[model samples]
Structures are given as structure tokens and as C-alpha cells.
Target chain A: MENHLKNLRAEKGWSQSDLAEQLDVSRQTVNSLERGKYDPSLPLAFKIARVFALPIEEIFVEEAEDKK
Target chain B: MSERIKSAGKRYRLEFGAAMTFYMVVLFGAKFLADGVEPGAWLTTLAIAPVVPIVFACIAFFRYYGSLDERERRLMSDAAALSLVIGIFTALTLGFLKSFGVFHFEWDMLWFGPFLIALWGIVRCALLLKR
Candidate 1:
């Protein structure tokens, strides 16, 4: 799954470590999420959405949905 | 202040200490404590002492597994599963070879625990490298 997590974090001026600290996860997890190598669980998705004050769907996009 | 003390790594460090205590005692006990043992009762007791710490290790590992995050737990589960699978096959082949007169060695239960630990460590490293 592709996500706007990197862009969102960028807009907030947060590095991967900064985002990981905010989310209480490892920086490696944040890096993987940014590179689309790992998908966050629903609860983690909600946390990320809450951190950015955005809807979950607005942050994550399925490949087909993104292309459309 | 690092919060890694609460991590699975710290949990396993304690577990490793427990395991090593059992391992060293059993592995070397028969050599050093070979004297002053009388008859079958004490011999049997000495032979079974290793099992006590092994049980503690199993409980420690169970707690460690339960405490891991999803990704780390998945990786650990995969490593353990692969370790068991590979350990079984290795034992089977070696046992068969020994039975067939192709190999001659006194392979006993004493070696089994250490073998599994070695294999599990190797499998975990291999899995991590693949990732």
C-alpha cells in the first residue's frame, strides 16, 4: 500500500525518527512505512491519521485507487 | 535515558542467562562432580538437574514471545518455526545415518538442547539477512 506518510510528515517538518517517536514505534518501522515496505495495522493507521489530523483514506491509497 | 530495557532484547538476555546456567552445569557437572556420588539415587538426581533450568527457559521464552510487537513477533515466530523444521530434519537424517553404520558417535539428549539453540540462532540470522 502506498501512503502519503512521507509527505505528511514532511509538511509537519518531522523526520522519520520524529514521526516514530510521536507514534511510539521504532524508526525502522516508520522508514518501512514511508518506503511502502510495510503496512501499518488499523490501530496504527488511526494513530497516524490522528497525528496528522487527516482521514485514514486520505493518507493511504490502494494502487488502483491511487491510479484512478 | 533509553527505554530498551523493557524490550524483548532485555527479556531474552535474562532468558539467555538462565539457559547458560543450565547448559554449563549439565555440560560440565559430570566431569567435575564425578566424585563423591553414592549409588543410583544421587546419580539419578544429578542426571535430572538440567531439566529444572530448561523449564525456566521455556517459560521465559513464552513471556518474551508474548511481549513482542507484531513485526518482531512475526519474525521470531518464523525463525522458531524454521528452526524446529530444520532441527527435525537434521536429527532425522543424522539418526538414520548413524543407524545405517555410515556414522558412529554417541549422540545423546545432552546434545539436543544445544543443537536446537545453535540452529535457532543461525535460522534467525538467516531470516534477518533475507529481510
Candidate 2:
């Protein structure tokens, strides 16, 4: 899944570690999320959405939508 | 990392260390006692004494595993699954070879634990590196 996590973090001036802290996850997880190498679980996706104050759909685009 | 995860890691280390320390002590003590005894129930009891600590170590490992995040847990599960699959195939192949007189060596059952663990570590490291 492609997500706007990197761009959103950048906009908030938060480093990966800072975002990881907010998400209560490891920095490596944050890095993997940004790199699109790993997808978040439902609860984690909700947490990320909450942290960014955005809906999950806004942050994470569906693969079909992304391909379009 | 989260404080919860950090504390989990610390607890795992402490528990695993304590268990392994006890295992070493019990193993050596059992070996020493067995040397002075004949083949009997007493000797058999001495031989399995180290298993108590090994059980504790396994408990510690499972508890630690429960505390990991989803991705980490997935990776660990994958590593363990792969290790078991590979280990079983290898063991079966070796057994067949031995039966066919193509292989000749005294393979101890005790060595399988460390072999599986080493394979798990190697597979886990490879998965991590691939990410």
C-alpha cells in the first residue's frame, strides 16, 4: 500500500523516530511504512490516521487507486 | 522504540539469561553425578535435570514473542516456520541416508534444538536484511 505517511511526517516536521514515538512503534517500522515495504495492521493504520488527524483513505491509497 | 517493547526486551534478556545460567549449572552437575552412577533410574533422572531450565527458557521466549509488534511477530513466525520446515526435511533426509548406509555419524537428538535455533536466527536475519 502506498501511503502519504512520509509526506505527512515531513509536513509536520517530524523525523521518523518522532513519528514512531507518536505511533508507539519502532523507527524501523516507520521507515518500512514510508518505504511501502510493509503494510500496517488495521489498528496500526487507525493509529497512524489518528496521529496525522486524517482519514485512513487519505493517508493510504488503495492499490487500484494508486495505479490509476 | 516504545517503552513497552523496550521493557519486554529487557525482561526477556534477564529471564533467558537466568534460565541459561541454571541450565548450564544443572547440566554440569547432572553430568558429574551421572559419571559416579550406573545405568539406572537415578542416572536417567540426572540426565533430564537440565530440561527444567530449558522449559523456563522456552516460556521466556514465548512471552517475549507475545510482546512483539505485528511486523516483528510476523517475521519471527515466518522464521520459526521456515526453520521447522527445513529442519524436518533435513532430518528426514539424513535418516534415509543413514538407513541406506550413505551417511554414518552419531547424530545426537540434543543437537537438534541448537540447530533449529541457529537456523531460525539465520533466517530471521536474512528476512530483516531483505527489508
Candidate 3:
């Protein structure tokens, strides 16, 4: 899954560690998510959306093939 | 997210530590016990080597039962599945070679298999933590 997490975080002037602290996850998780090496779980996605005051779909782009 | 999962993590650490200590003690104790004995003494050490780690891993498994959230559980399950596949493939390949007389079975390989399995499991856990 691709995401605008880094963009959003940057816009908010939040570092990966800051975002991770807010999300209660490790900084590596935030980094990995931003780097597109790992996908966040639904709950984590919700938390990220909540942090940004955006919809989950806006923050996370799920590829059509991944739907299958 | 849940208190149960948090406690499960704590339990896993405790159990892992205990199991490691037990394994070290058993491994070294058996070696010391058989130091002056005749041949086949090393066999006793080899035979007893796997039991501690196996028991430790089992305890970790049971402690995490029903405690992992969806993501944590998925990562763990996938890691274990991968580890099993690797471990089995390596063991089977070596076993086949031994049976074909390509190489004689060395008692050291007995301990080596479990070490590989444990190492794989640890690496998986570390990756999950990294995430």
C-alpha cells in the first residue's frame, strides 16, 4: 500500500519519532510505512487517519490487486 | 491495545529468559557431568540439548495464545510458518544426503538444527519489533 503519511507528517512538522510516539508505535514502523516497505494494520491506519483528521482512504491508497 | 496483549509480551520475555538460562545450565551441566566418561558421553549432551529450547518455545507459544492483536498475530504466524519451512527444508536436505551416504551423520548436526530454528525465530521476532 502506498500512503501520504510522510507528506502529512512533514506538513505537520512531525518527525518519524514524533508520529510514532503519537501512534504508540516504534519509529521504525513509521519509517517503514513512509518508505512503503510495510503496510499498517487497519487499527493503525485508523489511528493515523485520526491523527491527520483525514479519511483512511485519503491517507492510504490500497492497490486494486491488493483487494484480491 | 489490550492489557492482555501487553501482559503477554511481558510473559514472553520472562519465559524466554528462563528458558535460555535453563538451556545453558543443562547444556553445560551435561558436558561437565560427562567430562571424564568414556565414548558416547557426548551423545547424552546432544540428546538433552534440544529439550530446553523446545520447552521454552512451547511456553512462549502458549503464553501468547489469544493475546495477540490482528497485526501482531499475523506477523508472528507468518514468521513461524517461514521458520518451519526453512528448518524442515534444511533438515530434510541434510537427512537425505546422510541417507545417500554423501556425508555421515554427525551428532553436532542434532544441536545445529535447533539452533537454526531458534535463530530464525529470533530474527523474525526482531523484524516484527522493528516494524
TM-scores, all candidates, are 0.75, 0.95, 0.63
For model 3, the stretches where C-alpha displacement exceeds 4 angstroms are A64-68, B1-19, B26-77, B107-113, B118-131
Clashing pairs in 3: none
Interface C-alpha RMSD per candidate, 1 decimal = 3.7, 1.2, 5.3
DockQ of candidates 1 onward, in order?
0.30, 0.66, 0.14
> Could you give candidate 2's per-residue lDDT for residues B6-99 as a string of tens digits?
8899999999999999999999999998987989999999988999999999999999999888889888999999999999999999999999
Candidate 1: which pairs clash? none
Q: What is the lDDT of residue B83 in candidate 2?
A: 95
Query: Residue A36 in candidate 1 has what lDDT?
Result: 83
Error of 2 at B65 (Å): 1.0
| Pick by lDDT: 1 or 2, better one | 2
Please report the candidate that would top DockQ against the real structure.
2
Cα TM-score of candidate 3: 0.63
Which CAPRI category fits model 2?
medium
Which segments of candidate 2 are over 4 A away from where they belong?
none
RMSD of each: 3.4, 1.3, 6.1
- In terms of TM-score, how similar is model 2 to the real structure? 0.95
**Candidate 3: lDDT of A1?**
83
lDDT of residue A8 for candidate 2: 96
**What C-alpha lDDT do the candidate models reach, one value each?**
0.78, 0.93, 0.75
